[model samples]
Target: MKRLRDSWLTFVKKLPRAYSGRPMAFAVLLGLSALNFCSEWPQGIPRPAWIDTYDRILPDSFGSARQLLFDHFQRWFPRVPASQPVIIVAIDDKTLAAAGQWPWPRNRLANLIDAIAAQKPLAIGLDIYMPEADQTSPDKVAGNLPASAAALAAGLRALPSHEAILARSLRAAPSVLGAAASAHATADTSTDLRSAPILVHGTDPLESVLRFDYVLASLPELQAAAHGQAMLNVALEQGTVRRVPLIMGLGNKLVPGMPVEMLRVATASPLVEVFAYPSGVQAVGVADVQVPTQPNGEIWLHFASIRATQNRYVSAVDVMQRKAGAERMRNKLVLVGLTGTGLTDIRATPLGELVPGIEVQAQVIETIFDGRFLQRPAWLKLGESLFIIAFGMLIIWYVPRTDSRLAVFIRAVPKSSAILGIALNLLLLLSCVLVFRYFGLLIDAASIFIIESVVMGSFFSTALLEDEAQKRQDAAREQVRNSGKTGAGKVFDGALARWKRIHRSSK
Candidate 1:
């Protein structure tokens, strides 16, 4: 019985240390970080999550330091921008009131073309679609009118053959009219191209995000009427238009985008260079010249203030009513769009709220002209993953081993965990800011930090608990042995006195 009891006590004494808590702690930490990672994961994230947030906040803390590191990386590993070429001519509210009501008469548009032709821009782009005949000029539609509908049809006839008329007018001028083409779509495909055409298999800034369809409306008659065809589609994601399409694959046909079409006609170059990478692509000037780069083929838009004097605006009504001449539009891009109170053509962006369509075009122009690019290369991702994993493992080993009594006694495991978390976060923040500000590359860094912190912290916590448990067991065993020795001496002395008294009485 004594031997059995001794064996049981020995087993109990060793139990805590035998649990092997460090590996389990590592696993728990790793799992926790993963959970945090998925919870905060953003949609359309192109790079590592850590890098994305780092780009936003690093500038706040250590301004230029962040950018320096980023540039260092970009200089070593380069990426190409998208090559699709296009430009936007927004038909905004100022032009609408100036031009006269929503959907102005066809003849006024004809005059605008005649004026544009005089400037001889490579090719004029039309975003407005004229699919049906005008309802106010039936005589014109029937080919029985000698004059324009605006002069004769007060409210009696619908204008017939407006698309054909516009086609005729544009054909006669030095401009091109854009169209919408529906191609290679299944029954379940969502037809949400709005007024723009649809094309499948488009490119985006990153593989993780969705790409917009680059579709162009095709009409042989209209095609022949103009110098060239360009896709008139602008891509919008999460209620914001960020990317400018350079190339779009439609019906197994790689079509030239708005920018591409514009550059082709402007330069008359047979082959324009198309840049490709994670963020987006851009069409460069030509092969001989150094190719340019841009993030999502986007640039800063310089708005012509509505309050400006001569640059303010020219109303379509003024042109129609002979109040304004064609000279105002000479050698300039004229965008006509509606800005009526009820007619909402607003889109959200990183800049501000309630941005107009024409401004979007302006931004595109700024991006192309300025050559500001942002992106990360494929190798950067692999580098980030490896770095994060190693950082996490280091935290797991070092944190528990730290001899900071205050950390263990006061803040406990939470403090150590926090330290690990902050370290990982700082590394990510620095990486993103450095790349974006200096190198002009936008890499995601947030994802890596979150994942590493949890993975490493978990290992530390488990090891800490086990170590504490073993120490407690040793202390308990020491107290038990001391108490047993003290009690044994008192019991033995009392038993000897009683035995001597009993023997004296028997004698």
Candidate 2:
């Protein structure tokens, strides 16, 4: 055993210690290994198992390597087209202030509908839910209007409750109304008062997020009105509205989406395709199709400014009075919803804070019309995990073996510091101009930055200490040789040259 140990040590010493390159190679391998291992993590990020916890963290800005890769994948994939048949007529702040406070008389809304119907739009979507009878019904209450506006007073007396009046006007025109579902219902609430969603059979988390709770429009009434009804749920993750689900899962079954299915039914296209998995769901035109097995199956919204549509802004009072022109509203999508400040249907978005509920629906319509859906695949996660691990491993292998501290220092500098790095970042920025740029796809450059900085710093530190010691040794040797006057000059020069060569080769 002693002899074998001696032989092993001798063999190790004899082997040229010039394997400085092996450390770098080993680091590259290590980084690759880490990336491969991280690929298996569910959802691409480290998430808690509970739903509530996940929701709390969802809105957080902490992005992962996997998220970055997914963004890249989307850039490469083909975006579908948008074909929304609905329009939004926001009851904006101007109209709200002009029309009076909450629950502007039913007659006023009736007048607005009368004017909107004149446009002959494809259909109208009412985002407001009228769950109860209005207090200002002409027959139920009287003398609410000022005598000066009595000409408008005469019209108010004949109008029905807002629900009945809107229902009547909707029935008269070729339009669709909104409806809510009881997915969030509890036995504590009255079932009669609560509306049920147009549920299929199965219940899914993604579907729940996508389904909307339409107010007054019920299955029977919504079915009886205009042409069809849509599920009005907006899918929001992390308080951010990203994608609109194309299909909704209710209870224990799968059903066509409110807007998506409505358009499909109206267009007389094939059945609505269902694209669902553990990650998310997508719906395609029911012919030969592709599945979106990405993180969240949402499509990009193709927005049209709400103010752009003409005759689109008739006040309720103007519409009822028939004082507004109808020519501008022809062949447009009509969505009626409350844009009042007092109303609670507001959400925070990147573009603006406290955006109206109608705007949310408008976003949905935009995505539907554009057909540019966001998808994530398992491969994206796989790729990201591999990147992280591989990067980490590379640092471990490369820094220590390098004799040329300067080379390590060059690698330590971030890739973005140079003109090439800056140009690369600029190219990414330009990609957004030529195409769509998703911020989520950015790499964790800082992490790599940290690794390189530490590795390079350690190498330089070692080189500095060794250089000082060598200088001191040369000084001492020269003094001793000068005093003794022997063959020390040749030996010392040879040793120093060999040391420099070793350092150069290591680098």
Candidate 3:
């Protein structure tokens, strides 16, 4: 009875820990994922450094391989050309060389507007801003003159004010002035900007569109003169402009973006309509054009790989000098903005090209008009999360179920765990690629792949450590049994061991 009790105790001691470390490791992974997910909500994010390093080294959340695949798909398929009915009145190197530097006298801009207006363009998008009275206006210059030069000051005041000249030019053309959206506490909101009428359908999308605290509108004279005004606020991710908002909110009023305003004026769209589903903002409708957007009212830009502004640009100087013919602007929407190196409006696009900001605005209009979109529904993320959970549980189960001590030592080259991880992710990637090829739906596969790979790797380590512990336990059990053996039993045990060795060798 004593011997039997000792043997039972030894057997119980040799047993492995309950469920090994799988539950612990899996719980920890889940907790970390939960913490990372807080950023998606209103709560603050504890963006851990290790996760960031991993994302950067392999696949960043911002730069999912899906984007690369989608961009290339757009390239290979060639659905629509990047051409639009837009002419960029670029204040480029040539324009600056011909007409001096940026912030040129308002009279010069007025002349440029007059020249463009004479072409009978459908609508002009003036991407420049004149927030304050022109310093170079004749009347203002006159006020700055010394008292001794009273006659010169009086003569200067007699000429028409530069503001009047520009305002009159704006009144002549159906021009949409660009205003800067500001968040600074002291931002200018003295001149009330004309808000785009947003008619909400389902849920109120007042909270969905991008919001700015204040707007730096053009002077009251120019503001009242232009046919329309659009906010020049652009959102960027890591210096790249991949998405653009169609409409935004300034204080309590809704504002149209540069491209949307240009389209609105061109199509004579009286009001912008917002379709808000239970999920979020679905689409923004104006005139006959229906634009699908993300929940936040931004569209994933479908930028085609074409020659950088091959024939899109007409120099500002050319327009001002009448060198660019009226035919260049006839029936076309003209976008005017500075692209001089001194003016900082350059941005990177996914096509690996750095383009002027105005070109991006023009492309937004082109994409909306053409209906070429790369849609990634927000629910797809929920799908990915569900997939990761199910797949991770499978990895946890399979990693240790068939594992054995002997197999651990004689493990196949490129460990079985690694093989499983690669094969499964590759198959998933193939599926995602196919979905993108045919449907134009950009499903993000990188983040899910990273998550599952990390989870499996952790479980793999736990499995190895459990195998090692089990091996040690077996050795201890064998030692206890061998120690209890008497002379005859010990001889029998040695003979059995020799026989086992001979049998193993035979195998």
Candidate 4:
């Protein structure tokens, strides 16, 4: 037992001294890399503010650069022509100009639906919400009338309400109404208004889905009449819409989003299936279409360019006036929403354009059909941390050991202390870009570059300080040796030896 204790103590004592000089710097690099790995822990310690800022700025800035490259690729690459039959029926300035003004009466909307239904569209999703009864209805108007107008008011009330007309139209066609999920709770807890059943394939599925305390759904009459209702809310990051959720949780029930609901109706799938794992919801399947999403069931949309002459849009006025050709509208999923400036539905996309919110939804559906959604693999973070550690150690090992002559040769053109370091980092960045371009994978190498640069800089600074200290020590030793050979040094040395002998005798 004593021997074992002594051995343990010896190991602990030797641990610190084991790392010295270049090895000590390498040890510090490994320690920093370990911290980097811990920073990514799911329920780990909170990172410092500067680290958080570094993470936020570096990746987003690099992402913007990558987005530009992707834009150029889209322009130059030979992409498979998109053939998904999805169209946005935008209520733009032209549409509003031709179809009266904003908030056209529900009856007129009903007329529009009737026209679209005649074309046999696979599904009609109303991105616009009718939360309350239309104010222009006869009942609302008759209430403020004079008592003497009772007969006239009663006659007006006998006519069908606009809500009823729109509801009836919804029942006649394959329609899905838009609803929104709220972070705050409301007094209403009616579960009967839910439109779809959420099926869980794994344990604790609700924990992984985005939970909402309240839902602002369509009126009961409209919701009941429609084939299904889907949430219109989208997830935003830094006040910008980057990802769209496919499923949301209200209490224990999971609800579909507009695009997913539209796909359900189009595919004639009776139920939307959500697959879950211990981590979170994995993928959502609607009939034959399976969409893999983030743990929260949101997809990072790979946006395609919107061309003016493309079949991406058909003006609402054209649809209403029966001007849209049958060949274009038939068997297509149509999203109806306002795109006029004052509508406030504009969203900033990764493609660096402001498009209608409904257009974002259309893009998501198109991405799914095209099977070209961008994905960051689950193993990427682990792979990146390991790479940073290995590469950082390599830099620490290479920078100080690099021959001065070789460094001078490399620095001949640029004349920088970190010429090799800069070249290696650029190489790392280029490799990342190539991976993204070829494999559609987004690996964040910014952190690795930052770590390597810091480590290499420290290594060189230490080497420089050590060199200066060695020169000072060498100069002091040479001065002592010269004084020893001089006459004044010999006399002083003899006197010092006599004083040392007397002091030793007194002790």
Q: What are the lDDT scores of the predictions, listed in order?
A: 0.49, 0.50, 0.75, 0.74
lDDT of 4 by residue, 1-507 (tens): 999999999876545334324665676678766656554532112345676666665445334433444444434432343766687788889988888888988889999889888999999999976667788888877887899999989988988888999999999999999877887756542433457776667755666668887777778888888998998888765555667999888766788998899999888888898888777777888987789877777876666666531467788888888888877778989888888769847787655666778877887787788787666545676687778777776665555554756555655756565566578777877887677667766666766766666676665566666677679899999898876686877888899999999999999
Please give, for residues 1-507, the per-residue lDDT of candidate 3 as tens digits.
Answer: 999999998755443234755675577557645533432321112235665566555444335444565556555554455456888898888988988887888889988888888998889998888877889988899989999999999999999988888989988888999988877645446435865577888987667678887778888888888889898777786677777887787777777888878877888788778787755678888788778888877888877544745587888888888889769889889999888887858888777677888888888777776678877776665566677677777666656564765346437655665565578888987887778667767766765676666775665566676788879899999999888889999888899999999999999
Stretches off by above 4 angstroms in model 2 are: 1-61, 64-87, 97-100, 105-108, 137-162, 179-226, 237-239, 255-258, 265-271, 276-280, 286-297, 300-325, 352-354, 371-378, 390-507
Q: Give lDDT tens digits, candidate 2, residues 1-507.
A: 999999999765433222433444445445544433333333523444553454455532223443343334343432332444445565766676677776765556666776777877655666655445567777455467776877777777676555576567767765555555555554322223211233222224353334333223443432464455555656554464445555544444444435554454344353555544444443334333332323333443433333332323444444445554665456656677776567637665433344665666665555545544443345644654565456545544544544556346556776523544356446644553243434323233433433344444444444565577679899999898777855787788789999999999999
* Candidate 1 lDDT score at position 381: 51
How well is each residue in 1-507 modelled by candidate 1, as lDDT tens digits?
999999999876554334444455456556544443333332233547565565565422322333333334444433232321222333446666566666666666766666555544455666554545555445544456555655565443444344556667777754544444444453323223222222222353333222334333434445566665655555654465545555444443344445444445555555545455444543334323323434343322222222221242444444445455545555444444444555535755433344655445434543454465454444455465556556666655655554756346536665655665576578777767666657665564655644554465455555675778778889999888667776668688789899999999999
**Which wins on TM-score, candidate 1 or candidate 3?**
3
Superposed by TM-score, candidate 3 places the C-alpha of residue 162 at a distance from the truth, in angstroms, of 1.0
Highest TM-score, which number? 3
List the candidates ranked by TM-score, beginning with the highest. 3, 4, 1, 2
Each candidate structure's TM-score, on Cα atoms with residue i matched to residue i, is 0.59, 0.58, 0.80, 0.79
Q: Which stretches of candidate 4 lie over 4 Å from their true place?
A: 1-81, 185-193, 308-310, 402-419, 467-507
Ranking by lDDT: 3, 4, 2, 1
Worst 10 residues of 4 by lDDT: 38-47
